[model samples]
Target: MAGYIKSPFNYTGGKYKLLDQIMPLFPERIDNFIDLFSGGCNVGINVDAHCKKFIDYNDKLIDLLNVFKNYDLNEILIEIEGTIAMYELSNTSTFGYEYYNSNSSGGLADYNREKYMNLRKYYNNIKDNYDKFHKNVILYILIIYGFNNQIRFNKKGEFNIPVGKRDFNNRIKNNLIQFINKIKSSNCEFINLNFREIEPDYYKNSFIYADPPYLITNASYNEQGGWDEDCEYELYDQLDILSSRGVKFALSNVIENKGAKNEILVKWIYSRNYNIHYIDKNYNNSNYQIKDRSKKTIEVLITNY
Candidate 1:
């Protein structure tokens, strides 16, 4: 409850700032807790020992999680050190994407494709079952070393972040086994899935947090990412379903829904009976400016079911 949990990845729209505010809202007693759209695992790290399930939807994100699964994590930390010993500036964000994806033993590429191409398909086929594990800690660390710690893929599902941006060696695992030991006590679980396939009945007595892609003009999930319209609608439907099922739900999204600017989000959420928490925050990846600041809307749906 009084320690910092760090993620080696540079996750976009991460909730590191809101962590303090979020902790107080967790259900007093939870059979399991889930960060459904967990990006960087920031929330998972903080919720550490308090929850059981740490299901995440991002394959690349969970690929990194697998490293923490012990076998892969220990090896990854070793490789990180080896690569750094061979070269300096391992944490610089100036590295190239091709360096890792091209030379990797098809580990990183395969893991990402599983979520990119067949995300919807896989989500429907199994819905909530998470079985496959990909050893992608090296890939994420490499990506974090390059391009401002950005993890992105082209429409073709390829990691396209440029290299030599930042050297990853800067953040070496000072004491790896101990680091993994910290979160391992939390019984952390990683899940690779699409939002549309999540069932409403699964949320009973669970604390759910969602940080979905912001609906904005030409926003490609990420500069190197993509989000289809059908999938978007499906995600919204899934959230609405989760709301009615009595799940403790909280979602971080931009106010822009339709017709209205950012204002539409507030009205849209209220119309559904969800309490809205408004806060002014700096939009990620933007130049620091007063005008660049945007209002982040956190919608909550609480029920006694």
Candidate 2:
């Protein structure tokens, strides 16, 4: 229910509530704000007015920003609505892969239909997915714009997530226009870039919010074939590097054990840093059972000052 974007698909570690506490932790008077993971884009939109670069690795994510900023919002909806209804047919029918499973009752497959097909179609139409920029905004948008905002795929790169409790394609053009206008007025710049390629100078006295994938044995947020723990360690290494250069940073992650948790690596990673702060919070809508454990956590705010 954010102004423009729908608050980033209810992720496990999304910093929605913690923004108030996390904001004061951010270094004031920075020339710009940089969100490395930028999954739900809370960091970007929350501080969009002060950001110099709202970067992320997801193409569909950037597309949300781009289309909202550059394209006609009303026309985009008209284009999407015509294609969305094709998924409402019988589950066994020959509709596009974007439709519900008729049997996805409560499984994690929340991605079938909605805007993903349009995103792929849009990308394929543009003929630039192979380029260096790899503009795949439509693809990312489809993953989120779908029923559950679930991002999953088999070895063949086919999406197979189930349906959620509601439909997202029902939004009118006016909704998108207001959102687009909100983002357009902000001082925001979307970069389809990853952390490794960022220049060393970008970390100078800026806030780099790190919400990388957890270093765990199981993948949350319904994505299959999770990212490697080594990648997270590598990101932690980069976070430490940023801290050394006087960059202010805040990280949201699981710091306590809920029995089934295996974040020993995350603890090891955070222990290496200085000035870490712990904040208590809940993990609502999470598949984990938090009855025995406190849902609260230490929000690891890493900084030099």
Candidate 3:
């Protein structure tokens, strides 16, 4: 196995932590690899495959990924640094926190709040006119400084996350460089599409890996009925169709969380006799970290090999 390469985006529900447990279970040799519901692409980017396709419903995210795939690493970095200079955003990676009257524990949020807002406003305004590559460049920078390093948009289709406690430090820069290099070197494609629309039979000798929004978990994507019972059933239907076509697939989902159980998933998988590999997850201080462990949570990987 290759050394783990983390996704630069702090995406919610990412499988980065579980890669150690999950990747080893994947097929050793894959002809085509499809990362259905590829948020942040943590799993897809790390997989060794002849061809890789990252499919998602978020057009903006796909565009951003395309930017990473299509542009030169140095070009993207130059634009990012130029944007930072233009916005006068804090660069704690270069200047010490003491220079900004701040510290690592407190972060540079106080100094970057106003500047971040200005940058957000500028991005929202020029997003329509800016080229796809350059606009996504600004969007990437916004996400790096955005709250929790998340990519969020409002009902008006505007970037709405607030300034985070962190800045574009050296860690993020190095991660971005590696992510871009990985995308460029691999035979990868970014498609903005819903998982249901994909035709499983078209991808022969392929292995599909799905880490969709957990029906039982509460997250930003699952809020306001983003993913519901209907979506869950539809996904199951798609996976069944893939199985019928003899396509191998692995689905990562939580059947139980915080005292709530997904009876639908349990019934479906059991009835079909799918293989369920239990995942031992101890969420701590990370994004999906659960401080209260009083309630038992069960995560699993259901597969049709």
* Highest lDDT model number: 3
Tens-place lDDT per residue, model 3, 130-151, is 6887799999999999889998
TM-score of each: 0.68, 0.68, 0.94
lDDT of 1 by residue, 106-157 (tens): 2234323322223223223432235333225345444544445667666654
* Candidate 3 clashing pairs, residues 3+ apart or interchain: none
**TM-score top scorer:** 3
lDDT of 1 at 140: 48
What TM-score does model 1 achieve against the real structure? 0.68
Off by over 4 Å in 2: 1-8, 85-147, 169-178, 220-226, 260-273, 285-300
lDDT of each: 0.54, 0.55, 0.88
Ranking by TM-score: 3, 1, 2
**Best of the two (2, 3) by lDDT:** 3
Error at 66, model 1, angstroms: 1.2
**What TM-score would candidate 3 get against the native?**
0.94
